[model samples]
Target: MAVSHLPRTSGRLAIIAGAGALPHHVAEAARRQGEDPFIIALSREADADWSGFDHATLAIGDFAAISKAFAAEGIDRVVLSGAVRRRPDWRDIRPTLKTLAKVPSVLRTLVSGGDDAVLRMAMDLIEASGARVIGAHEVVPGLLADIGPIGEHTSTDDDLRDIEAGIAAANALGTLDVGQGAVAIGGRVVALEGAEGTDAMLARVAELKADGRVSSRRRGVLVKLCKPQQDERADLPSIGPSTVAGAEAAGLAGIAVEAGRALVLERPAVIETANRSGLFVLGIERNARERPR
Candidate 1:
């Protein structure tokens, strides 16, 4: 997969704005690649004036309005970035009639698990709209995290055992779309992320560790990975400085993520924080053999 060979938008344009810093980074990368990346700020989500890009505007769920904005600016490619809170709470996702028709099938796909169903539907809609959906990394090639453990400490034998255990549990749990992260201590499941999210799971792990009931030999280990059928183009698992903080608060010994399958936000800061806190932040490849017990 040639990740960096994005079709040249030499005289072309793009909408490089969304919910997270990834969109902002994508915009900058696009400009560096010689395309004038227009910015689209979601209501209360993105920074319109970020890095003084081409143009910016706030859209609140009006897909027609978004299309109009792109067409008016002659944007040929749309680079979606950041994470939009999913439906029900998706205040900014005003789907057109065409998109609405997809709602039922999309919901079914979501229910079936993984991100593919929704992303494929979205891609179809985007293509139907005459705009191409390109990977955000197409503009920013360096965002991909290198394979292997990426922190101050490598996984100890016990840590590896716990990690293996966490992987098994995470993968199995992911199949149910329950959560993508798990915390294990001494090869025993301490916590699993659910509707409460990773931070809450960390807190739960801390509470368990402090309870003096379980015989966990150490603090905890955090493992975050996407479901086997997750969409690579959308909703990829992400980690950043906040993740490190959460792990620290939970007394976790390390954090592991799927290499090349997850996003590392604020990489330098995340690594520095993990190093300072003595937390091991490693990237592991997801394979059937790596599942935890």
Candidate 2:
């Protein structure tokens, strides 16, 4: 079968900027591909410069409003990227009648957290509005990390054991919608993240170690994974140089993430910092199950 490539300059592109550095990266890549991206900034969740796109709009959780804005700009190609802060409480939604009507159905499909279903629904909505939702990575292929340890040094025996143990524990916690991250030392869990967030979880583990609740052979390990059935387009767990700083502060020997499933923002700097601190930063697949002792 002969494949036909769509001309890169063929259509209008819209960037639904959320938060963090990903959206900006996507926008830059879109410009490189010869499309002037129309940026829509999520209220308080996206960068201020996002408003400088060819056309821009600000909205909270109102999907209908977002759809209307896209329609107004005549955008037929769209890409969504960046960090969206999950809101369990719906008080601030201010939903339009159209969005309100879909809320019950979305909630029924979504269950608790994880935005995969919601993004799928949003993609459906975008398609219905006569636009195609493109994969965010297609615009920025280099952002994907190479599969491996991703640093200068290999993990020590103790570091490897802790990494495996942390991955297993994190996977278990993810099954419950608790979180995708955990801290461990000597093959034992010291802290499990929840709604409080990763930094807070690290602090809690540090406190527990100070109080002699969890002991470390030398230090601990931080492991983050993608929840089973997680939406890769959104809500994927991410780490970077700051994570290494957090691990150092909490006396962690290493950090492990699910290979190809986790996002490593600021890759060069993150790896450099990890190497400088003698921290092991490795990636493993989801089924790289920790062996039984």
Listed per candidate, the RMSD to the true structure in angstroms reads 3.9, 4.3
lDDT of 2 by residue, 176-290 (tens): 6568999878877778887776777888877777787777446878989888866565556878787888887788887888776677777888889999988878777767655
lDDT of each: 0.70, 0.71
Clashes of each: 6, 0
- Judged by whole-model lDDT over C-alpha atoms, candidate 1 comes out at 0.70
**Which tens-of-lDDT digit does each residue in 1-293 have in candidate 1?**
24566767533556535565667666776677777777667656565456586665656456667667767787777776775444322444566776667554644454453445556666666666667777666666756655676766766777887788889899998787667998888788877887666777877776776787545457668999877876566666778888889889878788888877777877888889998999988888777355322
- Cα error of candidate 1 at position 248, Å: 2.0
Predicted structure 2, TM vs. truth = 0.81
Residue pairs of candidate 1 with colliding backbone atoms? 61-92, 61-94, 164-292, 165-292, 168-291, 168-292
Candidate 2 Cα misplacement greater than 4 A, ranges: 1-9, 47-57, 86-104, 107-124, 289-293
How does candidate 1 fare on TM-score?
0.81
